[model samples]
Target: MLVTFLIITVTFAILTMLPLSRHEAWWIRGLDFPRLQLFLALLFTLALELSLLDLSSKQTWGLVAVALACLVYQAWWIVPYTRIFPREVKAANNSDSRGRIRIITANVLMTNRNAKVLFALIREFQPDILVTLESDLWWQSQLDILETDYPYTIKCPLDNLYGMHVYSRFPMMNSQIEYLVEPDKPSMHALVLLPSGHKVRVHFLHPAPPSPTENNESSERDAELVIIAKSVAETNVPVIVTGDLNDVAWSETTRLFRKISGLLDPRVGRGMFNTFHADYWFLRWPLDHLFHSKHFMLQSIKRLRSFGSDHYALFTELVLTADTNNEHNGLDADADDLAWAKRKTEDQNVDKSAVPQPEKHSVA
Candidate 1:
C-alpha cells in the first residue's frame, strides 16, 4: 500500500511540472486550472505517507521533499489571491456614490432554461450593468423584461456557446460586437458613462477555451487577449474588462494580459471567487473574471446563487478612485514576455482592431 501511494505521489509531482513546458495541448495546458486541487492532493498524500510509511529509506525522504516543493509552488501562485496579502484595489473612504457602479457577469449555460433564478438575483442586486454569456435568443427573450429598467443595451445572441449580451442603465457612449480571433465567437465592447459623468472603456469577451470539442490550441485565445491588452495600453481612459474568460486567473496568458494592459485584478488579496463548474464542487475554477484599471478600487465582490447554469454569477461593486500607493499585485512583463505577447497578438491579427459589423437585434 505504501509503495502504491508513493508512486501516485510522484505522478502528481510530474503533472505539476508539465505546465512549465508552455505547451497548449488540452491535457498539458489544463494543468493550469487545478493548482488549488493539486495543492490539496499533495498535502493529503504527504500526511498519509508520514503517518503510515516508515521514515528509514532515502526514497521516502526524496518523495517527501518533492511533495513539499509541489505544494509550495502551487501556493506561490495562489497566496497573492488570499486575504493575507494586501489588496491591489484599495478601499475608498469618501468616494461619491455617483462614482460607484454595481455590475454582474454570468454565463447562463445556453441549455439551461431556468432563467428565473438568475433573473431573481438580478432583481435583488439591481446592478448598474449586467453581462451574460451563452445568452442565446431564448435567454435574451427571458432577459427582455430588464429593458424596462436597463434601457441601454447591446445584444449578440447566437446558438453558439460563445453568445454574449450586455444590458446597462448607464448610457453607452458607443457599443459594438467584435469577432477578434474567431469569426463565430463574439465579444462586446463599449464606452460607458457613469452617473457621475466619468467614462470608462469596457471590453467583454468570451474567448473560446482550448479543448478537443472547441479550440485545439490556446493561440487564438491568447491572441484575442493580447490584442485587447495592446489596445488598452494605447488608451488614456480608465478601462474594465469582464467576462467568462474561459481561462484561469493564474495562467501565464492571464498574467500576461494584466502586465501588458496594466489592469489590476481585485481578486488579488481577496479570494479565488471560483465561478465555474457551479454544479461540481470538486472540479471548480475561477473561469469568470472582472479586471479593472487603476482608476477603480474594491467595493464588494461575491459569487451569487446559481441560475441552473454551469457557472455562477459574479457580482461586484466598485468605486472610482486612484490609489495613492504605487504598489499593487501582479508583476510587469519583461522584454522577453513582451516579445512573446507581440508574436501571439500578431499571429491572429485582425484587419483592424475595431468592432465588426454587429449582428444587432433590439430587445423591445
Candidate 2:
C-alpha cells in the first residue's frame, strides 16, 4: 500500500509540474493533465484511508506522508489573492454619462427542470445579452420567453452537452453555429451591434471537460479554445467571449487564451467566483467566465442565485470605452498558443467532414 501511494504521489506531482516548463509546443501541455491526475490520486488516497482503518502506525504514517505530499503538490495551484480591477467601476461621487450593458452567462443544466427559477432570474436581471450553455431542446423551450424581450437570437440546441443559445437585444450580423472540435457539439459566434452602433464580435462556447462522461482527453477542448483565442486575436472589433469554458481561470491553457486573445478576465484581481457543482459547495471552481477586450471597462461582476443546475450564473455589466488602447505589462502570447490554435482549427475541419449533424429547428 505504501508503494502504491508513493507511485500515485509521484505521478500526480510530475503531472502538476508539466505546465511549469517553458515550451512552444502545445502537446507539451498534454503532460499537465490536471483534472485527471487530481481526481485519481485523491480518489485512491481517500479510498485506502477510509477502508483500511486497521492499518499499523507505520502504515498510517506512510499514508500521512503521501497525503501531505499530495496536498503540497496541489498547493502549487493556489496563487495569492490580489485585486484585478477596482472594488467597483462605478464611482460614488461621479456620475458619468456612459451606457451600461449587463451580460449574463448561465449553464442551464440539460437535466434541470426548474424552469421557473431561470425565468425569474432572467426577469430580475434583464440583461441586454444572455448566453446559455449546456442547453438542449428542453432548455431552449424554457427560455423561449426571452425572445419577447430580446429580438435577436442564435440558437443551436442539441441533446449533446455542447448545445448553446445566445439572445441579444441588438441586431446580429453574420451569426453562425460553429462546431469547434466535434460534431453535434456547437458554439455560437456572432457580430453584435451595441446600442451605440458599435460592433463587437461575441463567442459563446461550452467545451466538453476531460471527465468520464465527456471526452477523456482535454487536447481537443484545449485546442478549440486556442482557436477561439486566435479568432479573437484576428478580430478588429472589440470582443467578448463568455461561457462555462470547463477550464479554471488560472489554468495554463486559460491563461494562454487570455494572453493570445488579449482579453481581460473579470476575476483576475477579484475573488474567485467558483460557480460549479451547485450541490457541493466545497468542490467548485470558477468554471463560468467572462473575457473581453481591453476596450471595455467592467462595471460590475456577480455570481447570481443558484438555480437548479450544476453551475451558478455569472453576471457582468460592462461599458465600452472609446479609443482605449492600454497595454498590460507582464503579458505576452506564448508561441505555442498560436501553434495550438492553428493545429486545432485544421484538425477540426478534417473531423467536420465526418462529424454528426443535428436536426433543424426553428428556435435553435
Candidate 3:
C-alpha cells in the first residue's frame, strides 16, 4: 500500500512540475477548473499517505478510500456537464437608465509585438470600455487608435507585467494608479461617470502569480484582492472590477472576495470562459474575470481570440441599474480575510523599495 501510494504521489508531483496539468485533462475537456481538480487530487493523495502511516489495520481501507476520492475528482468535471451555461440577456429586454456597457478585457502579453492582432480585436468588438493588462509603453503606442473612441483613459504601463490600463468612452473620475504590493507593480483604480450621470468604480488588477519566479507566495496578492473586495462592500455606487486577477474563479480567496464585495460573477450560471494559456487550448482556465456589484445585470459574456498574448480577451456586457433593494447575495468575508488583507497592506508599506513605481508611458 505504501509503495503504491508513493508512486501515485510522485507521479502527481512530477506531472504538476512538468506543467502537464497546466490545461484541463482529456476526460474533462470543457471543464475550466483544472487547478482546483489538481489540488483536490493532491489532498486525497496526502490523506491516503498519512492514514497508511498512522493506522496499521485500516491501511488498506484508507488506500481504497483515497483511490475512490481521486477517481471521483478525476471525473468531477462532469458535475457541470449537464448544467446549462449562462446565456446573454437580450439587449431589447435591458431595463436600465444607463445603456448596455460593453467591456473588453485582454492581458496583452507584455512582450507580444503583434500589434495588428490587438488592433483587429478592438475593431471587431468595438467595446465601450477596453481594459488591457501587462501593457507597457510599446503596448500603449499600439493602442493609439483607441484614444479617439475612448477619450477617458487611465494608463499604467510597466515592465514588471503588473501594469494595467483602462480606456472608456465615458469620463473617468477619481482615477488613480495603485500599487497593491511590490514596488513598480501597479493596478488601475478609477471611477467611471456614465452617460446617465451614474458613477461606477472600476478596479483593474494584475497581481503576481504564486510561482517561483514571482512572489513565491500568494499572501500579498490574496490580501490585496481581499482589501478591494471589502472596499467594494463598503462603497455605495455600482462597481465593476475586472482584470487578469491571477486567481481562479473557484478559489477560496475569490469566493471570499465575492462574498465580502457583494459582487456577482457572470460565470456563475454561465460557462467558464477560460482566457489564459492562449497557446494551448486544452490547458486553459478562466483566469480573466469581470466581477460586478448587484447594481448591474449581466448582458453577455464571451471569450475573444488570441491577441498575440498568453491570454485571450474576455468580452462582457453589463447593464448598469440602480440597486434599490440593497440586497447583497455574496458570501461574507470572515475575520481571517480582513486580517490577511490588513497585514498584507501593512507589509507593503514596510518595504522601502516597494514604493509604487511609475508605469512606462506611451502616447496611445
TM-score of each: 0.94, 0.75, 0.76
List residue ranges in candidate 2 displaced over 4 A. Answer: 1-15, 18-77, 80-98, 323-326, 336-364
Per-residue alpha-carbon lDDT of candidate 2 for residues 264-329, written as tens digits (9 for 90 to 100): 776665667778878886576778988887667766788999889999999988777753444352
lDDT values, one for every candidate: 0.84, 0.69, 0.68
- Give the clashing pairs for model 2: 83-269, 84-269, 274-285
Q: Write candidate 1's Cα lDDT for 210-307 as tens digits.
A: 88988788888888888888778667677889999889998888999899888889888889999989999998889999998878877789999888
Those runs of model 3 whose alpha carbons end farther than 4 Å from true positions after fitting are 1-6, 9-33, 36-64, 70-97, 322-328, 335-364
Q: Model 3, range 111-142, lDDT digits (tens) per residue?
A: 99998987788788878899999888988887
TM-score of candidate 1 to 2 decimals: 0.94
* Candidate ordering by TM-score (highest first): 1, 3, 2
Better candidate number, 1 or 3, judged by lDDT: 1
C-alpha RMSD values across all candidates: 3.5, 7.3, 8.0
Q: Supply candidate 3's per-residue lDDT for 52.
A: 54
How far does residue 266 in candidate 2 sit from its true spot (Å)?
1.2
List clash counts for every candidate, in order: 0, 3, 4
Residue 215 of model 2 has an lDDT of: 66
